[model samples]
Target: MIIERKQYKLLEKIIFEKLVIQAPFKIPNPMPDEACFLYMLEGQINYKTENQNVSVPQNESVLLKCGNYFSQIKNDKSATLHQIIIVHFHPKILKSIYSSDLPEIFKKPSFIDDKIDLSHINNDFLIQKYIENLMFYFDNPTLVNDDILILKFKEIILLLCQTKNASTIQQILSQLFSPTSFTFKEIIENNLYSNFSLVEFANLANLSLSSFKREFKKNYSDTPANYIRNKKLEKSTELLALSEERITDIAFDCGFKNLANFSHLFNAKYNCSPSLYRLNLKDK
Candidate 1:
């Protein structure tokens, strides 16, 4: 089934909370501004993405990028899972905390590497306690202090890094910084329909525009504009399949200037016009 992209909530720019999820639930694909860390408190979770599938058991944590597609299948019918403390923050929040020395891992999107498992990390008890405290604060929002909350978050990440392989840290950082270099699967799943200039995107990564463009091309073998346009076309196809919206409206909503330009790009990218694509989808 084709899924429509939902506008992300820009909640507080930096916010932390606890998540308790039941089994057999699917998490819809996230928007670019939302990222999360899942630390399993009890039971087992089978997580699937386009490129990989991972089974996370109790006391294990998985870091998910905003662009990644993930769904969970519960292993036990009676099992209950607690995602300890989830910290959702924008890139700007990290910049304010780390300044220019922001760790490279935070720059790019990555699944925490296999070599770096949180289950074996020391201070698991401490981490659990930290989460408990945060949850308490969440329950009592009136007494929450931003400074203390941010400090606790920094401590949690620092400790996780200390327990992980050094190389994994570097790779994660690189991925966070260069979103344009994201894997082809990620490119398709991320729903990059919003039009953004190279300069604007580079600024998000704290990189000079020219340097960002150079690195982007080197990694993805496509210019940012072309990549974004192609992604929009892909989304337009899904919208055509699932919605009764007129092709021209869908084109403009997806960032095309006009129907002619949208049809031309769609044909170039998919070798079919929008109406024909929808017709084929209906036939299927």
Candidate 2:
């Protein structure tokens, strides 16, 4: 399935919101700037990350860091997912909380260069409580003060850190000061061509091809080639929707080798060829 990139209007102030989205059968590429916490409320969600592909069954929660390349493949049947997505204004968000005299856990950076393990925290009751608090904040977004909300967000992090299976706070903290060595963002931005290979991608991530493939499957539930194709197809669809470009031009721009291949993949993904898909949208 192809992963579509959804564009959102940026919010000037701190925002807290809950999202309920039915899994649109196709997989979606990662949003570059947003940091998300996804809780599986009633069904299954398959997520592929740079290093792993994991499925969050009902009642499980997952944390996704910013700039991590990922895609989601949902089950065929309807599955309910409640997500708390917070887009921080970079250093400002961290600076506000770091200056406070909160616990050491809160002082640590919330955004890290590497992915931290929150999977070991097995207390379902506590997880549910956090999810509830998240929903409450979403319900009363206006009443929620940025400072207090930030603190509560800190508390949530600290609580998750306290979970038995969570990595030691120190280990997680080390990531803040560590050098930002990996360049998944560069890979996505520079190599939009269909010819890019998995071996090359693995080399860029500094992992063996086997290990990279394994982790990629674990995080995204799709192989590297499939993920890239999905992203390209997503871009093609967006262009088709908003631009006056010709079909052959769109195909080339999206890195497809030819018009026929683009139509084949687009039809397979959206259940309609590119021309018909655009026509249906125009009708609407």
Candidate achieving the largest lDDT: 1
On TM-score, the leading prediction is 2
Number of backbone collisions per candidate: 10, 13
- Tens digits of per-residue lDDT for model 2 on 8-63? 22224343433455543322223334344555655566665545567776667665
Clashes of 2: 13
lDDT measured at residue 140 in model 2 versus the true structure, 0 to 100 = 60
TM per prediction: 0.50, 0.51
- Scored against the true structure, residue 2 in model 2 reaches a CA lDDT of 22
Q: Poorest 10 consecutive residues of model 1 by lDDT?
A: 1-10
Cα-based lDDT at residue 127, candidate 2: 67
Q: After superposing candidate 2, which stretches have Cα over 4 Å from the reference? A: 1-15, 25-35, 78-91, 100-123, 168-185, 189-284
TM-score of 2: 0.51
| CA lDDT for candidate 1 | 0.58
